[model samples]
Target: MTLKSVIFDVDGTLADTEKEGHLWAFNRAFQLWNLPFRWGVPLYRELLNISGGKERLAYYLAQHPEYHPLSNDEIREIYRLKTNLFMERVRAGVVALRPGVRSLIGQCYQEGIPVGIATTTNYDNVETLLLRHFGVQWKHMFPVVVAGDEVPIKKPDPAVYVRCLEQLGVSASEAIAVEDSAVGLKAATGARISTIVTMNTWTYHHTFLGALAILTSLGTTQTPAYGTGPDGWGRYRVTVDQLRAWLV
Candidate 1:
């Protein structure tokens, strides 16, 4: 299989957005809404199993029946608030592209390999994050961005990845997906695309049974990724050439 493109999952895969950025934003939204409940790190970890911000909130409500049930509109409002807060954090430089992410994206661009985004996060969130890191021309750099709003279903399902593959004009075998959780791995592999799982503090314990490789992080020359990989793979960094070699 030849790697003609690289598809990235946002949220945790591109950056460590769960614990600090997302969790904080959710809690802040709850506070502003005067909700009696707050999602702690541990509680949010359980909710992370559910993809999409609104879905996570709905799941949390389902798990705890004591809280007042919010209508669909209310849930959307909450998600909107949380997204705004998250974007503010991004503007404040609270989140960043993960180690080696920018370099790897640059490598793909330089090599003429199309880079795409397949995420269960809202387009606004993706837009804001990339604007801060990739500047105003982020969309030009990433030609295909299939965000949560674009898909009826989210991760753990193949819809987003399938749509992304469609837009990229590539078959599953021609693209490699970079993900950070079991749900993402399931989504990518379900699309029949090989995926690499990168571990973060929130998702390191989750199973990534079908991933092509599971690394601690993308890693830089100074901070090498620590994880399991195919033979001849290196941890010092995950470059475009290395990804292509893995496909070979």
Candidate 2:
């Protein structure tokens, strides 16, 4: 099958938005709320297994009853505040696209291959990162953006990826999904889409069992590409051509 479109996951796949972006924002929210709670790196890393921000917070609250008396509405509000803080930090230029991301996206655009996003992160966070990186007209570049709030279920469920494929009017066989974690890999493969795994700091330890390729990053000509999988193309930097070859 010919590759018709490329769908991307936002958080770790697009940029290191988890540790540098959302985790910081969540800590800031807790501080602002005068809550005696903070998510250190190890705890936040574990919490990332949960898909959504509010869901993660709810899980944390349940684990530690001391933080109770915090209702669902309060959790939602805290997540909202965290989103705002994340956007502010993004606007301040702390986050940047992963290696080869801009080049690959631009290549796809130049070749008339539509790019879409399927992320469990909220739309506002998506907009913030894209606008900061791709400018005010980022929506024109990414025509299909199915975010967390838009989906009933999150990754490891395939709902978000399925929605993205639906919005793009493309079948799973005709598109490739780029993900950064095992949960995301599950989501993409569950939708029957071929996927590429690009591991980030927080997710590097997670297993990527069904990935077509698992790499440190979508490497550029300037950077060495290193990966381990049944796919042989991991020896060098992955390009649009390599992705097409993997479509099978």
| Deviation in Å, model 2, residue 101 alpha carbon | 0.4
Worst 10 residues of 1 by lDDT: 227-236
- lDDT tens digits, residues 146-217, model 1? 998898888889999999999999999899999999999999999999999888988988999988899988
Q: Return model 2's CA RMSD, one decimal.
A: 1.2
Enumerate residue pairs that collide in model 2: none
In order, candidate lDDTs are 0.90, 0.90
For residue 68, give model 1's deviation from the true position in Å.
1.7
Instruction: Enumerate clash totals for all models, in the order shown.
Output: 0, 0
Backbone clashes in model 1: 0
* lDDT accuracy of residue 201 in candidate 2: 84
What are the per-residue Cα lDDT tens digits for candidate 2 across 1-248? 89999999999998978777899999999999999899999998899999999999999988998764588999999999999999998999998899989989988888889999999999989998999999987887899999999989888899999999999999999999999999999999999998889998889899998888888998888896688644664465777887888788
Alpha carbon lDDT at 31, candidate 2: 96
TM-score of 2: 0.97
